[model samples]
Target: MMCFRQVTLSLILLLLGQATPSRLQSLGATKLRLVGPGSRPEEGRLEVLHNGQWGTVCDDNFALQEATVACRQLGFESALTWAHSAKYGQGEGPIWLDNVRCVGTESSLDQCSSNGWGISDCSHSEDIGVVCHPQRQRGYVSERVSNALGPQGRRLEEVRLKPILASAKRRNPVTEGAVEVKYEGQWRQVCDQGWTMNNSRVVCGMLGFPSQQPINSHYYRKVWNLKMKDPKSRLNSLTKKNSFWVHRVTCLGTEPHMASCQVQVSPARGKLRPACPGGMHAVVSCVPGPRFRPQKAKPPRRKDSWAQQEPKVRLRSGAQVGEGRIEVLMHHQWGTVCDHRWDLISASVVCRQLGFGSAREALFGAQLGQGLGPIHLSEVRCRGYERTLSDCRALEGSQNGCQHENDAAVRCNVPSMGFQNQVRLAGGRRPEEGVVEVQVEVNGIRRWGAVCSDHWGLTEAMVACRQLGLGFASHAIKDTWYWQGTPGAGEVVLSGVRCSGTELALQQCQRHGPVHCSHGAGRFSAGVSCTDSAPDLVMNAQLVQETAYLEDRPLSQLYCAHEENCLSKSADLMDWPYGYRRLLRFSSQIYNLGRADFRPKTGRHSWIWHQCHMHYHSIEVFTHYDLLTVNGSKVAEGHKASFCLEDTNCPTGLQRRYACANFGEQGVTVGCWDTYRHDIDCQWVDITDVGPGDYIFQVVVNPKFEVAESDFSNNMMQCRCKYDGHRVWLHNCHTGDSYRANAELSLEQEQRLRNNLI
Candidate 1:
């Protein structure tokens, strides 16, 4: 049916004269599509589709505001600049529209009042071009971020709160801190020049805090014996200088970030003084909502029990929750914990204190990343029963000479969603593969039951799969009559479970109200076929570091690449050697680290044939490669259109089975690697105008989350890089699994990885 649908759609498109090789090709057939040249998706010549033919927009009265609307239509944040005089070469065919006017905020160009359609006095040489800014521009952050570095690496509108002596640290993030703003890549103090709780609310929301509560700074100082610096004090006794960056911030208490709030910003340095004539910097304190606060242990049968404060601990530099360098609060300020004598017991204590179950792994020697500030405790010992790390013993001189490199780390055992025995798979071949079932607790008695077969689909099955830690959802079984009378089976508990499939837990699924089963478990129970073959795709760090290089390829030889839109905007000019594109090239080896093979979702009969690559595209997009700034904004990205999957190498116990060439099965067998050579087509992010600086090389596999896997946590790989125009240095390349193990592994373990790689 799918094949027939695809063929019929192709015929319809051909009849309409709207065939395209790109995804969503027929979408908005009479609308706009950005064409011509560009290294990334955000930059291109403006083209419009009128009637049946695609045409170009004339550069008549076109401005940056119009470019902004066009870029937004192409799904970009905003426009950086627009080109005139056919900078990306002239377009052929009819001039769709001329005298186009836009107010910059229009949803689409057509909505912005143009000179009708197909009306223009100019030729193709008047075609307009545009370059867009990447979505989510924070500022240029770097690896060498320090308090003494001044205002160089800070973002213009980034705001943060720092704590003095008595305050919440990284572990207890929501409790309290002094507000600070980042300007020109440096952290600076915000002057208390008309600051209010409305501004505090906005800052707290940005920090993941829910609400604002009035805090008595004097009471806190007295309780913790905190001695704050006097407002009139000088940085040094020699000179009296006030540290301030933002002044007179005005917020209505509803903005998400400080950037959204109205504020008078200042570049206060040298002779330029701060705006606060009252000699005070803005300060703020927040009370964490119930969700951010750890659960308290209530005394049994005690009417006069007092509530105890939750332990203070936090993870730093973690991409996701429950992992990172562990920090503990001592006295008032938060500091890193020493890795000396660090074990799972001490890690478990830290995890439990932060409202997590147990420690999955105790990472030593700063596995997440190096942290700033002091190393407070060392040689910490815990028996796994302590409620907090404060109950553990520490070395006498723990903080004497510890460095950030020795900072302790941990990966907490966060349950897949909140399904802690609430749901299970019954009557399956393996533990990870099974039919779905739900457990309900009523009157202190637990009852095991099955889900009703009515309206049960793959979307609901996804939540079940994730809850079971069995990877992505593969198939949803509507009926379970074939597997009836099996072990762990029970009466039907839930009926008509409707899920959007994005939910983390099964209980979160919307139901058809109080589920009433019309039949027994064996007759109407909904079954699921979960796969244990969840593939863990990890990038080869060694290949990226050793094989990375820059190349200047001619437009002629890159014809196949151009079809995939791999070249920059200048390529459209038909200029030969002078138009050669400079590309940062690197080989990427993707390894299947799971117990089962990684297979393509589409069947061979329906595979897309790419004329450029002369191969059947088994998968639309297998992975995403991006060059991002330190603050997680993408600078350049690889347009990997399609992939021909195959096993280039395999582990000792695995065998080669899949290949890209010919009509063979396409997949990466367990313990095997799929190598895309350094010079492979579309394996580079065009860095035309990117300045030399620190960057993060991030690659995410199955970004669409289409395929099933055993685990999705290890699908992303990241590396810190420093590019200096002529050279690129890739460092700290690792996956989440390696992060759980430790940043630096033993020689024996490294050898084992090499042996397992194909």
Candidate 2:
């Protein structure tokens, strides 16, 4: 058997000098033994004769496949047939056959071991043994013959194997056509036509050396020279830094060899040629073969002209189709039409588009406007036209601009009217003042009057007055009988007639008859008797002023007038005694008494006044003093103090008066004086024994701050001490007049003092 054959081979190998202890170790031989092929046989199991003994493979799941794999491992092809359990004989050793599957390509017998050996269960009881025979080697002689071929047949020309060695001397020596480069698995010459120090540096870089190191070391230059194969290939002459020929020549450029161009070599005694001088010129040519020109590229074809393309338009559902149906243009390929359906009726839109005036008319067939570009319209429904552009699809390909010289046109009309007239009320009084009388005359006749008051409760008066068919009176008759004793009175009268109770037109009544009117006490008449008895006991007549007569009036009436008028009066009125001399003089001489008459014949009297006085160095400043009456008053003897008083009552009328004054040296002037009532007139007289300085005085009036002047400028006044001897000085009068007393210390000054202390 297989063991006997292996023993014979082992004996034969022992006789030869090639067999050593290592060879014996690899074969696992203690001593050689002889056995026959059929001495032991097992199906689906592997047997090995090792150390002169036979062993089994425990095949728990061993079969023909595993046996074939074991046979092939012993250099046999595969199992010729399947063998069952103990078909040859049960081996004395443990059966290791278990779970074995193989593709029959294993390399050794012992490689086919299965599960743990020698168990009793039949599935685990099967064992494997091999009947292996020696395999003969093929192609052995051919292998020997192949190995006999010399290193020259296996030599690699693609890579250069020689190391570049440096010589001890000879710097910048000429190497004429002496260098070759390995390229494309071949040694090729490098042209030197345009070689330069830069090219030398590039070569030095390819060799992994610094550019300056190669240029400064003579050893490097010698090493480069040794690296060259041919020493006479024309790389000899080159010098000078700026020489044009010093640049490297490249395979892609004018020259293909290093020696084809001149190059500069360093003259330094110890410097080396830094690099191969042709690297910069060694670019691979893109052209085919060795030619330099690149092949010409092909051009693209032109696309079809837009006019020749088919006309197409896209439409959305629900879009109206008529003479104004949406249409697209086929120029430069078809595209959606923009909605430009416009005409005289809708020319406002066209006018907006062309930034023109309003559209006057729509012209077709080039009458008003011409259609130039492709008509792009959508949702266009022109009722004025006959044919829908979209329906006339064939027209899109026509020569006459889509078969229509005029796609659409519009005429615009410009507006001619200017701003119109409007009525604006310039001035009027409120209705609560018993029918505010207003006169509006376009030519010269009164047009409107007795308008309602801006506030409530008074509109009823206006309505009742108008209901009586009476025109507004020419002027306001305040306190007239018409308004007297009436809570909600509105009426018209004829004669002896107070407008306070009548609602009849002036022309409807007798000029001298008793006036018929309405009253706030409930509608009634002057001559007509009331069928119902008057209240047994009338409440005390509530004479509420419907309109504010003065600033001190009720709060509700205060705001009844225009806000500006009320504010002006409130602002200008100052704290001062009323019915003072200056105020009396002011009212007497300046106010228009004729216009202020409350009754037809009785004139209004001036009763209000405001006064203030002070003294400084014989200078008596009297504000609100009446100058018009001062000249007639007698002067007391002791240093008669006098002055030309200037009135400061603002919106109220003003008047001036001259009063002579006298005082002693050191200015025996009174600084202050109390305003007192003199025969129902208030006045401020000089007081003695008062010294010069700053002082404040306040006077209390029955109704302090009552404003008479409603004009904004004249309503308010303020008083302050003036060193200039004026009674009223407006600015900064409260603080003392010492400049140094309020000077603020600077930070730097304080800091300097602190440093000085330190």
Candidate 3:
């Protein structure tokens, strides 16, 4: 409890001092501080002190990494967002840092690679600011409550959901309620003035349900109007003793407790602060996943099948636990939400529905990068209390004017974890290109040293770059002798730094401690060149939709498909070479619309060769196809197993570089697409034994995370499938990305597409 100041812990980490890094000793006295508005504590325009005068840092290329370093230097835990174009107003001093770059792990900004101090092409209009928080120190904990308020103090103490109309027995824990807060020993109903579902979400989270259920706001206002005006009414009687608790309540939806929110306390009972204004008491309902539905306790019955239905919404392609593009399940397919009017309230509704506290930031312009798929929700209007995004008011169709660049993303406040990585990149041409360095304890003292490069691979370098907050590793360098670093860093500290490529940090990678290095010189230290973008693969939905047809193939002719397990379980049970299976065949063209090429994870030497297929399978388990009931239970699977990647076609000016010929490298280049003919062996979903019914057909490319990509939200394509006894009707086939915003769908075309798998 005595560790009251978070800055004290930050100082401890700094004192553990690795080898003298960069020119920190010369500019070591350089200071950093946040200055500007007094209202927002620990948040303001970022200025650095150099040559004894404070000056603003240029926003030329300022990003999350720079903001992170600034926040950590100022003693805050982490950064929420970085502001450019002088968000807090321009300063009146020399610009100190220009084109400044940081990996965010550095104790001092001087360690970062930059264009140079005072050497800037920017002016005052390019100044940057940042917003940081103080309560997210992952490892440290305060035994006593931290009520020590700095410039900003706690907002509220006791807040509870006050159940209305519900019986007292079921209301003890209070799952559904009109919001109330306790102030100075008096409990009062919170005013609905400027009330949003986000406020309801905060109240629901406090009551143990992070996912706030949808409440009929109109019905509640009607009920309050009907009862509150009566002199003898119970609600009207309570007003004699207490008035509205707060004039206005503001929450970002990321707050763990209501006290963390900005609450405008009610003034003494007066006409100045009107009673609830045009609004009534704020009511909220909540449900805890599938386990605790806020309803009256009832005996179990077979009719409770609603509890087993698939969730209509999901988060995808998020690097962390609770952040990603919001996708809604619509008409048997997953699609993205358009960023039209996408803001905190809508983002908060999504976060709450996903069981996260609140949205820390509602990112726009595809900050997480564009995803592939249909943009389902456009101009989504959420008051924050919706059970899901689907419950909010939104445009009906996917044919919105929005593009993938306008895809919306939400960063939710996730629980802070305790794991820390001492890995960082140093001695490179730029911040994103560097030799890897790690702080390891040697003889009870933690010191910086290079990782031994003996047998070091790209997987190890990837963990290093990611630990530094850089993007995917583009190239893993086995030798770092050309790069310069601290003299002590020449000694290799970590040897055999092998990783399975799934680790987020070098600390989680497998390593040896006895210091075994085949190459004595740390020159062979592990290093990496990082890039912000990677290839993403999405299939041509129109081709799949129009080319689909069914065929009955005898078991004898499917020897290759059977070898790959492309047939269904029913095929395995059937008599060998005697029975026939119904196959749903379609032409699939996978295009690479990303910045990089989609290469096979394995090289030519490691590719698995099957006897039935003449070519090598570069990637194992590349794609998946499934036929599911409307409820999402799979009835049949596809012949999709592995992939032999190669550019089958290219843009007019581009040439194919990768081919799957005899012993060749394989990949699908950017701006190119590889197509598989409908008649290709095993390129269909097996539906021989499936009964005639409505079903959902889905396919996912690179179903496993064996390779890194800039975005994976668009890797899956789905379609609505209907079957009568003799034919299969495929419709609404779409990839879940905004690439089709320009393509208008004709109802007749989709409605007329009918065939059987051949």
Q: Using lDDT as the measure, which candidate wins? A: 3
Put down candidate 1 lDDT per residue, 476-583, tens digits, no spaces. 776665564345557666786888654656777787567665666775577666653345566777678777777767666778887777765556776664556667
* Candidate 3 C-alpha lDDT tens digits along 444-527: 898888888887766676667656667677678887778876677778888887887556568667888698988875577788
Locate the minimum summed-lDDT window of 10 residues in model 3: 1-10
Candidate closest to the true structure, highest TM-score: 3
What's the residue-level lDDT of 70 in candidate 1? 74
lDDT of 2 by residue, 1-758 (tens): 12111111221122221111100102222221112233221122344434323344444555666655554443234455545454434444333334555555544433544443333344323544444322211110100000110011221122111222233122111111123344324443333455444444223222211111112234534543543444542323221221111123322111111221122322223443434443311221010110101134222122211112322332111001101212243422222232122223232233222212223333333221122224544223322111123432222223323322333433332211110111111112333234332223335653432222212121122223332222112222222334332222232322222232122222222233342223321112221110110000000001111110111222333232212121223323533323111111001111111111111111112211112223221222212321111122321101111221211122223222212232112110111111122221122222112223333211111111111110111111111222222232212111110111123223244335335646
Task: Summing lDDT over every window of 10 consecutive residues in candidate 2, give the lowest-scoring window.
Answer: 140-149
Off by over 4 Å in 2: 1-45, 49-53, 58-60, 109-113, 116-758
TM-score of each: 0.39, 0.14, 0.42
Give the Å error, residue 2, model 1: 69
Off by over 4 Å in 3: 1-323, 352-357, 365-369, 399-405, 412-421, 440-463, 478-486, 489-504, 508-524, 540-587, 593-672, 676-707, 711-758
In model 1, the Cα lDDT at residue 270 comes to 57
